[model samples]
Target: MSLEKLDLASPDLVNENIEKIAALFPNCVTESSKGKAIDFDLLKQELSDSVVEGNKERYRLEWPGKREAIVTANLPTTKTLRPVREDSVDFDNTENLYIEGDNLEVLKLLQESYLNKIKMIYIDPPYNTGKDFIYKDNFSKDEEKELLESGQTDEYKNRLITNPDTAGRYHSDWLSMMYSRLKLARNLLTQDGAVFVSIDENENHNLRKICDEIFGERNFVAELIWQKKTGSSDAKNIATITEYVIIYSKEITSLAFNQDEDAHDNARYKYKDEYYEERGPFYYDNLDRGTLGYHESLDYGIPTPNGGLAFPNGRTKKLNDGWRWKWGKKKLEWGLNNGFIEVQESSSKDCGWGVYYKIYLNVDNEGNPKKRSSPYKNIIQGILNTHASNEAKDLFNRTGIFSNPKPTNLIYNLLKIGSNENDILLDFFSGSASSAQAVLKANSEDNFRRKYIQVQIPEPTDDKSDAFKEGYNSICEIGKERIRRAAKKIKEETKADIDYGFRVYRLDESNMQDVYYKPQEYDQGQLDAFADNVKPDRTSDDLLAQVMIDWGLPLSLKIERIDIKGKEVFKVAENSLYACFDKGIDEEFAKEIANDSPLRIVFKDSGFKNDTAKTNVKQLLKQLSPETEMKVI
Candidate 1:
């Protein structure tokens, strides 16, 4: 009856993938240092038709750090997201999330809850333009303090070296950074989901190949050419006015992109019908369509004005040639009776008479209201950098705050195409949170409650930058403020009752003490000092947040705190989980919670009076709610 300790760490993506593979092909699974891992050689043999040999030439997007990137993606992070209630907006009820941290670690943390849950992903990562950016192509851990002392890395350990084209690993390092993120991002997509990545001329081709490798070549949706400016004098030879938004679907079979509803050709519906209000207009098409191989049943005649039946192609029933009625016998009868058929005297001597069936412009024969939509074009224009700057000016009443953050309109367009009602959208490289505002704006117009998660690294802003001067010390601050300002502006303008708030969480080290993860590394005296597995600085809220993540519960889920016998208890998403972190947790509290039949239960191990008390609490829950999964931290 001993309660198991909750790992309370980011999911081990490598182990999870191996377990998945093991479930499909059990023979490929083997023991490794990590325990329960895939034997790649065995897996290859299982998958291949012939013997798999040494490194063979194959088509793939490779880079110097590709192996490291893949390893980094598979590595488990001990980082956990702690709720920043002070920085949050409507922390208790809001569906949106604004996570602050390095996106790589943040992506790893999110893997547990958000896997296959996001409907759309939009990212505007650092464009690697050899300017102010992080993750420099050149650096070493051994020179870390020396590098920082010499102004190489920032306080947050973000390498701030200029990665010019002359650098040995310019493209390789950028690709390495992007490859791991994209690898993790691909798992967060729903089957019908797609990712839209914004890039310039420098890396669009490389990104295309990378996406093709990750999302599969067949899942490549489109390379949308967005006109960022009318023209740019900064360009040397050809004006670099355009950029690209490359899209790739999670699964090609499930991906069905939306179309432009307003762009349909309205003029084509020139003719009206009795069903105009329901089905709109009507146009006639020949009922007797000529066929290469006519069926005998389709060659039958329709009743004419002369009381004699008119055969197909003026045939006298005895003669035959390849011709058939577009509508079947039953449909022809129904169409004629329902005012859907039109009969007229023939212009040609061959047929002599003609029969036409009305083609409704909007709805089908069943009369369900249908939409005529124009295909979403690959070329996006009119959404420009000036609009984005104007938006910054309008929001902050200043220009050059974010150096041309994406216009909300651009992401709004993407949302319309890739997502709809109640769908979740994510942006890992969420600078200025344009994607967040887009979700809010779209929901207001469409009345669809589309939620979003915005993850941004708190990259420090330049001292001379307007954003830094305006009291926004970092890009995270700018992003948070933009959402706040944009929410107010959009709400006032539209007066829409949409979610205008987000829960803020900052990524940090796990809430557990080091001895909890590695007891072997600590001495008996050190272990004695760490009787409480949880970190001293961490709060009950922090513990709850980590437990929620480790339990694979989304951060957006509703949490209700209630006091049971002078002890605080958190009930997440109505019986999804129940946790009590207060001291002196006894059978009395356990029985009360067990009555509600929670799917999962957690308690701080130190909360119990002793080991016997912990056993008693576990036994109490078992008798009351046998299905409840008990865990401790």
Candidate 2:
């Protein structure tokens, strides 16, 4: 059978689960009056005692809008991402992305293509400080119509609403906003992926509880305390100097952090000998142990290098009734044979001699010293808030283009620990585009190809603010400019061959017309109105973009245009995908494209010359490359 047009709507997860359960237990699945649904009674019977039933007491984080938040996440949106080539740098080649929209809608639009793809997500969301602007998602309202009516949008039509402490649903509104976005973001993470969220004391506890519920408590990595400043003068009681970075992994066992070695770690390995030079320097640890109880196995003594008998001293008493060597007999013997144990003369009056275990510098199996490094600790100090503000000033060339932008170094360190070369890093709350700058800087330093996807709502700048006066009307303007300036600065400074560019995409209504959504509502007379299925305002590039998303292809893929006969063909990622939205596409054009043997292809349904041509196109492709998947939109 030939392929049909992809359903552009977001996946109905509830129905998907129902079908999955129906597959496992057919008896439990039945058609309800509303439609197909799982019979919970039957399912419980099938599961027997294994399933927990009823409204029993359970450990869960609950709030006023928790249920609505879940519904908002599951509800599909007809929104699409439109490419803005004008706001982009190296649009055709760059793997980086900067998406301007409500993060909740943007995350949902990204769910398909980026599912299980992102290696790391770092977000500095609003900390709910009573004055912070929180996203208000009105699922009931039409996004496009709402923006048009408000008249507050710039060219991109991005909008936001503030959440003030005076509102009755202050905490509930903030929680609701974060809950849906976080839920969708979890799906985009790779199995080894990790998410880092920055927040202050304002909602740290609440954020942690919700994160526990969403990411599972077992995947919780660490709660890092970042010293934002030496101290804050605005504190009422305790002088709060630190904020937190809550880290969680998609899968705890699959995740690992890159260790960085500081001067202090290198100093730990002190002694080096010619024999152990290949293994690097090492330090000695006393082999004596003080025991609270008797242990028969570790009570033995050993012969010293000076022909002296050294008795085990437990440190509590002289070599008499105390415990002995820390290592057991077998390990002690192995260490002695391997030259890992050393005997030295005792300087202390309590013991005759001291036994030492040589702890060598961490090394690989090849006897080469491992990368000098230490595991990332929970406490992150030395980074100051002033450093972040100064970074903003330097980038914008204005005193206050953006306030309190995160230091690029801070994000760079986080990226170094959580990701590697060629991995994708996303920041849905990419205020000031700090993570984007950090990604570029990191890539330049390490000669990597890591990509980033940054999303920020175009929150309006206050008229009296310096940023507004400096020609930035919204937060997104500052973010885009920051990336542009940062990319240029990095290229000039490092001269490294890195992708110092990003494509810009803005969230908007789907390119498909209303007829495509509600085909059953129209009659044959009205069918003429939908001769061109795509919206009139949309370009061929816009339709191609939606096709890319519909097919779960990366938006960063290289696109090239070529003429086959008189019609233009769009080739994406070489031969990974081909789309021709032009009308009157005939059998000859289809054959010309099939000759390229693309993995997948799409075309406008009405673009075909006729039904015969359409059938011929399918047959020709099947004959040429039977494995090729073809779809018509």
Candidate 3:
């Protein structure tokens, strides 16, 4: 989630491809004294405060910590959540995604591939109701820190059921879990994006404060209230029906919410009965009292079109206060001619003698739809058992995957109000895949291309439940089934040919080269560099792809490979990026490549045969192509 600033022209950047770098960081680049380049350090500092320019100024930075700390030993956790084989569940190319793993680890892994790409985040984490399990999330143990320092991905550890009802420390566990996850989720949000968290009364207040701390209090949006259930016929101590959704943005004012349309439902605008007279069925009050250009002398003796003297109460005098009719006399007369205005006869003392205007039912001009304000009411009638049951039935064929599922209508309305069709939606606590289903359904119905990423832990199912009896073995299984069925139903209904498929990315041990962790000195004489016995599981090409994802590079970015002398070199089309991860590269190879003028060129630290040769290569490349960037992978 850290934002790093980059300088395409810096010596650290081996690639001198200015055009390609500009394309990668479209808005972050500026015309500096040298040329088009990025301010990497400034970008990193802004992330600590806020991102700017519609999320375009944001970039991923290295994790913060002491750079020279000693490495520690590593150990494996005794308790781990295992994943079941999902061979049976079918996943089409749907935009919705679901993963089973600890969300913190998943977020770290995703940082290499989906950083700063997500636009919206929504989660319904456990309310810490004394029974809830707060993930222990201690990733850097002393031993693990050593392993990471020596180059390795750390295995995480977690704990459950630590919230004690009377410990007065009950809020501590929930706050810790939420704080870490919110920090990670904030990284995932686009600069012009936000997050919404659903919670009951128990921890809503506590969660709001933590969110404010992470996203900044200035970015806090509205706290939406949703009625979770209908009122019961038999009540005890008052039924708890509503829940709250606390919202915040990565950058204030970047995200947009739909303004409500005003309601012009007034009974005075309705006609009583028609056909009684040419004026039609009309109700009238004093028009002259609030009319424009009124004089006290002209108040009582004014003439009506019907040849009747205007009543005393129908005063044409202007009041000291700013009271006046909205329309002028010509407009009032036009309304009378159009049978919309009328004069009341024999009006009682309290009813007054002023003329009233009849605003017709389907004929009045309502103001802009965007001018409406959101209504705050305690009861939301849309929440009912039938609604929940029907949504569950549609996703799981009435088997009822989970009992405490939120109504789709609730999430649906929130998405409509707080997000756009093209926004990226996320659900870190995706139980029963309700949020995923809601996103697919919403997109298909609205002809929008909204995307979603859902994360779930493959927690085992209860043996006594129907899901267990029906061969549904785990929560993740139920989630996969729900997504499968939802996609099929949406395709059948919409008949729209779209990529409903998701790129299946599973979390595993890093696909990095093992040689990256070997000791500096190896074997008898130590003539050759030490390399891992396991060989490299991830190639340099793979690392390049991972970096692309980390830097918020598009998946479809064009890349090409060229052969210089006897070595294979990669060229990124848009950035004019040249990467040489190959080892034992000589000066002739570097010079020949530099002759073609690459804007940026990256070589492996182990690529050049010697330090003198490496220095010569950089010097030659710089002299030949002055604007080219050079770096070592």
Q: Rate the local accuracy (lDDT) of all candidates.
A: 0.83, 0.81, 0.58
Candidate 3's C-alpha runs over 4 A off are: 1-97, 109-117, 139-168, 231-236, 260-381, 468-474, 513-545, 554-633
**lDDT, model 3, position 41:** 56
Best by TM-score: 1
**Index of the highest-lDDT prediction:** 1
Per-residue lDDT over 1-633 for candidate 3, one digit per residue giving the tens place of the 0 to 100 score:
111212111021212344565566656566777566676655554455665434354332212221111010011111111222243232322444566676655554454246677877888888877876566444455655554454333233223334666756567656666776677678678887889888888988777776776788899987877666667666577878778888898998676555432121232334564543432233344444432344444334334666655444544343443334544566666776666556665356653335656543334412112233455231234665468778777666764567566667667666665556566788878877777777877776555678777777666667988778768876767777777777788887775444454433344443333333333544545524333221255465554544444343443335566788878887666446777777777778877887778776676666677778877887777788888877653
* TM-score for each candidate, following the candidate numbering: 0.81, 0.80, 0.55
Candidate 3, residue 146: how far the Cα is off, in Å? 18
User: Distance from true position, residue 426, model 2, in Å?
Assistant: 0.4
Model 1, residue 107: distance off in Å is 0.8
Top-down TM-score ranking: 1, 2, 3
Better of 1 and 3 by TM-score: 1
State the lDDT of candidate 1 residue by residue for 484-595, as single tens digits: 9999999889766689999999988788888888899988988899888888899988998999999889999998899888888998999999988889987788888888
